[model samples]
Target: MDSGIITILLPLALAIIMVGLGLELTPRDFSRVGKHPKAVLIALFCQLVLLVGIAFVICKVLALPPLLAVGLMLLAASPGGSTANLFSYLFKGDIALNISLTAINSVIAAFTLPLIVNFSIQYFMNDGQQISLQFSKILQVFSIIIVPVCMGMLIRHFAPHLTEKLNKPLRIFAVLFLILIIVGAIIKESHQIMSYITQVGLATVIFCICSLMIGYFVPRLLGINSAQARACAFEIGIHNSTLAMTIALTVMANSAVAMPAAIYSIFMYVFAAIFGTLLNRFSRDDVSSRTTSPT
Candidate 1:
């Protein structure tokens, strides 16, 4: 809630979490994109294009306040969270594809996120409210994202054993930090929390369901295999809310602009688990039907 924490501690925490993400990554993750170009490209299109459109629609239809609308767009612009790999592994998705998507998406988001958020601010904040992500702020976003990731990659490349030792602890810290940021954002907006939720809750829930469905079904319809489709599902479904919130609180310096991400974080894991379970059930039924069919 404190400005000191927002400006200083929040970014430091995000850098550590991203560094942990980098430790999990390698040159292989980025290079692997070439091997599964279809899956990667499809996921990115769904994320960067379709989902952003969906969020904009939700914002307009719901008539969200300007800050909240921009927040939703910011969440939409975020890349897949590192946790998507874990979800993919649990749900029988292709983990390698998940990693590749995360790797590629992270790089792309550094450039696109600023552009998207800037557009949202300009378009939605037409109430004479002056909130703009200028060129310098864009560079800050780039450094906040890419620099730590590169640092972690270098550490892993040079001292893999050390990277291994740090990985689990850092992951645990990432989860805890995510929880803390959500709570902090909520508390900072405590007085308006219910009003904000009433305004943004349905939009976020609908957006989450649409995200998971679009992420999975579009890839499936496009001839991607089930395993790869599941990977696409989670990768596109689980956004890096911490990044959105950090940028909101620190970069834009608006707690209201952080609200959508904070609320969406609460719904994502629950919906993702339910969606993964349904996918597994369908996979099992398909296998049963195949095994029982005349051979």
Candidate 2:
């Protein structure tokens, strides 16, 4: 595959996903904060603080290559975008809240992602390898995260019906892009994935579980409702590994660096969905059950 394909595919995929995200939301979607501030903050806290800490530990424990390690860190910072909304709908969560979180996370990540990713590169860069940090990487994030999202928002603002019509097909395209990336990664790194499967797979699974835990429990502890807690759980567990892998393979052009994210992209969905289903099962409507949430 051409580096150009990866370059174009990476940003175009993100923009499509972001636009899909915006199409689902309205201005009133963001108004949930004044109505429900604590829940939102708790969810954001899980995303910003706990997920990053969890990824840092995973990278350190596994002693993954520095590029791969930073790639994991990038995953931590990148939260639910297009995927979260679908999961929210599937799991009967509050979709409006999920969209709001997605929109907000995308905006915050514009700055936060660059900082975390650049630092992770420095922190985890292996001794033998030399990688350059470029300002264009920041621009890439903006192009992917900001530009299409704004376009979608504008469409929503003016022509909501068109936005609605485009929504389904765009989502389908996002899924196809993800599948292609996953397949490409697998084909390119077959032996590397097989050799490092135990280490990286364990890290991905553990991190996914940890994210689900922190996402759900943290919000409940903050006195959020079970539905809101459910939203956070899915959002936290589901990372934007596509962005991380893009940074690794397309921008950084490091196959080893891209592996963690590529592997994580596979693992998180399985583990997170099961975790969400389990949460759906065990959770009770009783206020007491969720209010305490077993710490």
Candidate 3:
């Protein structure tokens, strides 16, 4: 596929996803974070903190190239994405909370992602040359994730009967198609993907694990329950890699920078499934103990 085609494909798919997100949400969903500041703050802090910490370690200790490191940081900075709502629903998490967190986080990321990315480029880009940060790029990202999302929500708000009818199949299609995009990306880059898999692969796996851990414990350490912990784990830890890849291929125009998200895109679903299953098992144990203990 042409780089331009690859560029166009992901963003178009993401716009569809965002529109669905908005259709399912209301303005109240966007504001729910304020209603529960703890969950909101926990999700936001984990995302920002982990991006900086891991990007720093990857850049400084591992001495990875700047674009790759910045790519990883961008992955961290991106929000939970449309898929998380599915994951949250399947895992019996607070869907309302998940939707709210994703909405607020995606908006905040519009500003924060560029700042973190440019700083990482400054420190790690190897040649010490400035990384590009154009206003047009920011607008494109906003269009890709936010604008369509709001449009969807508007449709839902005005024509909720239709939205209610369409919501389920649209969500299903979005999930399945996004999976295909991930597969296509890997298949298209089969040879190079295999070659880069080991180096980028290991880091991607570690990042997912670390992200899950932080999303869960960081909240619980502050006293969030297991259910909310499960919610936070997926929401904070799972990033919108499609958006990250959009940035890399479109804005950054470097496949190496796109590699982290490609690698992560593969790993996150596997680990998220494993993590959700494990959390479910633990939750069952808690239920059993509580029933026996009369709480």
TM-score of each: 0.98, 0.90, 0.89
Q: Top TM-score: which candidate number? A: 1
Residue-level lDDT of model 1, residues 1-295, one tens digit each, is 8878989999999999999999989999999988889988899999999999999999999999999999999999999999999999999999999988988988999999999999999899985276779899999999999999989999999999999899999999999999999999998889999999999999999999999999999999999999999999999999999999999999989899999999999999999999999999988999999999998
lDDT string, candidate 3, 126-158, tens digits? 653545656787777667777988889889978
Q: Ranking under lDDT, best-scoring first?
A: 1, 3, 2
Tens-place lDDT per residue, model 2, 47-156, is 88888888898888878666667667877877675687677777877776787787778778888887877778777776425665579867876677777777888899
lDDT values for all models: 0.94, 0.76, 0.76
CA RMSD of all predictions: 1.0, 3.7, 2.5
What lDDT does candidate 2 reach at residue 61? 80
- After the best TM-score superposition of candidate 1, give how far the Cα of residue 55 lies from its true spot, in angstroms: 0.6
User: Whole-model lDDT, candidate 1?
Assistant: 0.94
Model with the higher lDDT, candidate 1 or 2: 1
Clashing pairs in 3: 22-153, 23-152
